[model samples]
Target: MASPLKVVILGGGTSGWMCAAALSAILKPGTPSSILDLRLIESADIGTVGVGEATLPHIKEFNDFLGINEAEFMRKTKATFKLGIEFRDWGQVGNSYIHPFGTFGQTLAGVEFQHYWTRAQALGEAASIEDYSYAIQAARGQKFDFPSEDKESIKSTFSYAYHFDAGLYAAFLRDFAEARGLKRTEGKVETVALKPDSGDIASLTLASGEVIEGDLFIDCSGFRGLLIEDHLHAGWEDWSRWLPCDRALAVPSERTDDFPSYTRSTALSAGWQWRIPLQHRTGNGYVYSSAFISDDDAQKALLANLDGAALMDPKPLRFKAGRRKKSWYKNCLTIGLSSGFLEPLESTSIYLVQIAVQTLIALFPSSKPGEPIDDKLADEFNRLIDIEYERVRDFLILHYHANTRTDSALWDYVRHMNVPDSLTHKIEQFKRRGYVKKYRDGLFSPPSWLAVFIGQGVVPHGYDRMADTMDDATVIEKLADMRVRIRANVDAMPDHADFVRDYCFVPPAKVMAEVSK
Candidate 1:
């Protein structure tokens, strides 16, 4: 019988537990029983940022991959279903739009649907392009339902994610991982020891003076990257220029009687604020630049927006929005905030963690170190992750850069700032022809771009020429049919708050009252 290799994971936040969950699910009953001696170490003394309360739909795949029941998962996490995000006052004050997860309509005549809609709008025969989106209708109507039938029907055309309590989610994953044979150790790592010859992490000594050894180390340590950056000397990539918000104040409030199934990102003077509704409570936060906005003002802004009674005091958090130069270096690999961080504008933190763990599993090395694991393999893994990060980064920047709100210095700067060439080209293409071209296996597809671009007031100059093949009246009628179908379906959905209470409500599974010392 073969022995299981020792797997050591540092830190116990969402990233750590996600890694544990994935590894446990795959390696628990490998070919032979007990083939993975997985151990996770984290300190109760350390605090997690705990602000990524919203998620992308990709999380469904992760949970499914782990055999998690959706209702049960949501119940445990106090999660609320999310169809998309509502960007309020982004293009200008009092103007809003939704960035949904589904398509605009079927691509038209070998040309995109958005083009035909754009042409109709130019011809004064159409409403906003958003009118054709089923998700937009459902979100606006505050409805929730799973597509039990034809997904192509406007009766079931939208995709969804979740707004959950982060701490509860970590605890849920921890339970899942532990149940699958992963060993967890509670301690503070005092020092990270490197191999004398290679300078690669060989072991970590705990505050109790006990040493834990492993051939490979997974760093889930938050911002500090204790092992990956602090000890390993991995460099940091500063993306503060492109993403300026650095400080945030997060607080939870009593659950509102009416819970919408969508997250809200309201444009603020220096940054933006997020409103995430969970079954148990409402999560609100003001993410902003300290240089431009005072901490007191940030706190005040967060407090002022509460729709319910305060559950707790505002928690302050600091961050730099960027990734490490090399997420994988030597024998240690960094995931989560250790790897990099983009603002949670689109609720991508969990997805990033999911991607990293999946990538690590796919690129899991041979038991013997320095025998087969090489830079080429690492490079390939990092390149995919790098591109994914860059893509998400560009998407986030578009939310800020494409806005027409230039009333404040913050907005003015972001409005006139020079964005990445990649983003610029995407905008140019979309505006020129109402066309969106996605990257090779990209995270955001054409519809995702269309939602944001059109929402942010990027009106196209012309529709696709081929779209002209469709008569204007015919196009308008088809679009109207889409709207009618969507409205009927949305009106039939169960109330979001009611659906959650019946299906996925958890009554305070667990709460961390304080940071352990």
Candidate 2:
């Protein structure tokens, strides 16, 4: 029998623990046929960048794959449901719209609903596109409920994500992974040793002089990229000229009575601010460019704009906007911030980590004696990782480039600066006919693109010719009907706070205890 492939994950935050849990669950040891020996090394002195409070609906799939109980996870983590993200001023000041998690209106005559809505607008109908989305309506009404299984029903049109404490989540997964037989090392890594012949990592030496050997290394060491960059010299691909926000001021504030069902990103003078409400408290942050705004001013801005009393002094985090040149090189794969960082404008940090872990598992290699590392697998893995980063980069750029805010140099610069040809092409295509660029795999879907395009005032000059085939009266009537049905469905759903209280409410004493600790 071939020997087991020893997988050593370096760093312990959400990424490392997630990888550990999944690997331990899928490849349990104790049998000769079992193929993986998993261990995660995390240091007590190192702090994780845990400001990722919001998430996309895909997190549910990740949790389900690991066999975690949804309610229990939510209760333990102090999580709140997220229907979608509400943008306050990206298009222009005082203009608000939500990028929902589900589709807008059902297709008409095999054509997308946005095209029909565009045609209706040209015919003197003036309802906002937001009127036809079930998710937007639910979000606006502060309602929450699981989607129905009936595909034809409006109640089934929307999906949900979560707002939780990232630190608690990592701890929860630590317990989970350890229970499944994954070993944990508590010391900090001091140095890495490489093979002279292949330059692949051979072992990691800890500060205590204990050397741990492994066949494969996974780097989740945040921006430093200890193994991937410091050791292997994987170059960085900087996108700062496009996404110049280099600093963030994150702080938690007291929770309020109004627990909305969505995250909120409001445009600021030099950058933007985020409002993420968890069950225990509200997570707030100002992601801004230091070149344009001083750190002192940014801190003051964040403190002034909070929803409630500040729970703690604002904490600062710094980062550039880009991914590593190669996510997978030789035997080491970079996940999370080590691989890349696109701002959490759309809550994609966790999703990126999830995708990398899933991709790695799919292309897992054997490390039998004298077996060479497969170049083909590494190449394919890098290709897939590139697609994920570039696609997400373009989507985040759209949020800034498509904006109509011109109050500050920051907004004006992003609005007029030249974007990637891929993004420019997508903008032009949407401008002409409201057509969204499709992809085989990536984050944002058509509904997501349409929401930003229309919400940010990127009105198209024309609609799909097929949309013209529908009579003007029928199109208007159908849209009006959709609006009515969406409103009714949202009205029937329970209040967001009430639903949370019933489903996964954390006890006040437990929450306070965690806070005190």
Candidate 3:
């Protein structure tokens, strides 16, 4: 048989190590029939952009695939459970709502629950839509429990994610990868050499005069795109017109004893502030457009709004909202910041990396030894990546475009700015009659769209004809019943903080003592 494929990954933060750990586990490095020789290059001198503390539910699947014990991982990373995101003052000055990780309510008689709710709402017999979601109720009550396996139970309706320290999680994955026969080199790359004929990456020269060659190269380099853009010149497609927040200031504050189980995104004067509650500290940041807000003011705002005493000074970050023209180019693939950066409004940063790794494994190139890698494989991979990025872009745009905040120029501009036709169509469909378009792949099932649409005061003018088949009184009774059931189930769950302490508590004192060692 031919020799195993040599795969080299550059950079070593959350993205790089996640790729390393997942690839090494699935590709099987040291066995007689090993399919891959995995290696990673990262520098101790370089610092990573590690402020992404909150995540979506998909991360659970990634950890399970790596055979990581949840309790151990949580303790190591100081993670806390996340039910969903709570939006504040998006629609208007005093408004608040939650975009949950589960359904709003069960469908009734071949019609979506939204239509029935809409019909009941018009008759003045319905309550707020938030009442029907188990996840929203649990998050609001500061309660959490693992979803039940029984489908009939209201407790089984919701799913969960986590808020953890990005730096520590990367270290955790580094240990896992290294223990599984994955080689790691400590140095900075000086130059990337390309094959004269095929223009594919031939090898990398480290600053220390060491040369490393591989059949495939993965770029996890944070915004610089060292290999994908700096070397290969993969073009960037900027989406700043719609997503104008180009700068951020992140800092950690003292941990709070009464932290909630969900992330909080409050609309600020110029942009927005994010509060992510991890076990050790609360992650706080302000994402704003440079045109609307100065860096100094942004920093001050973030520091002033923190819930507890500041732990450290803010770390400034700069990024454009967009994706690479070709995520997979020649013999190199780009993941994480190198591929694209959609701001963490919905905490999708890690989920994007997870999806890229899974998609690459599914479409890994196949060729005989000494044969050229197929361009068709690259084409398919890029096509899939485009679908994922575009879908996520539209979802994020919905949050800004649907808002009615007139307190700031930033809000005014985004509220009236033209959006992508795809997003416009979805909004129009929902407005016409509470109908949400479904996708075969990518983020945002119907429930997510419903949450945002209804939350932002984009109420529909009509109901689906199918919803009319049910009696109005009957629909109202069903909606009330769902609210009661959701409340009953949510009240039974333990307090989020108490549950976390029992499940995976790692005292800050213990962590500091270990560091002191």
For model 2, the superposed segments whose C-alpha errors exceed 4 Å read 30-32, 515-517
User: If scored against the real structure, what TM-score would every candidate get?
Assistant: 0.95, 0.98, 0.99
Q: Can you list the residue pairs that collide in candidate 2?
A: none
At residue 164, candidate 1 shows an lDDT of 83
Could you give candidate 3's per-residue lDDT for residues 326-443 as a string of tens digits?
Answer: 9999999999999999999999899999999999899876765346789998898999889989999999998899888878999999999999999999888889988887889887
lDDT of 3 at 53: 95
User: How do the residues 173-258 of candidate 1 rate in per-residue lDDT, one tens digit apiece?
Assistant: 99999888888899999988888888878789999998998877899989999999899988999988889999988998887777
Scored by Cα lDDT, where does model 1 land?
Answer: 0.84
Alpha carbon deviation, residue 213, candidate 1 (Å): 0.9
**Lowest lDDT block of 10, candidate 1:** 508-517
User: Between the candidate structures 1 and 2, which one is better when assessed by TM-score?
Assistant: 2
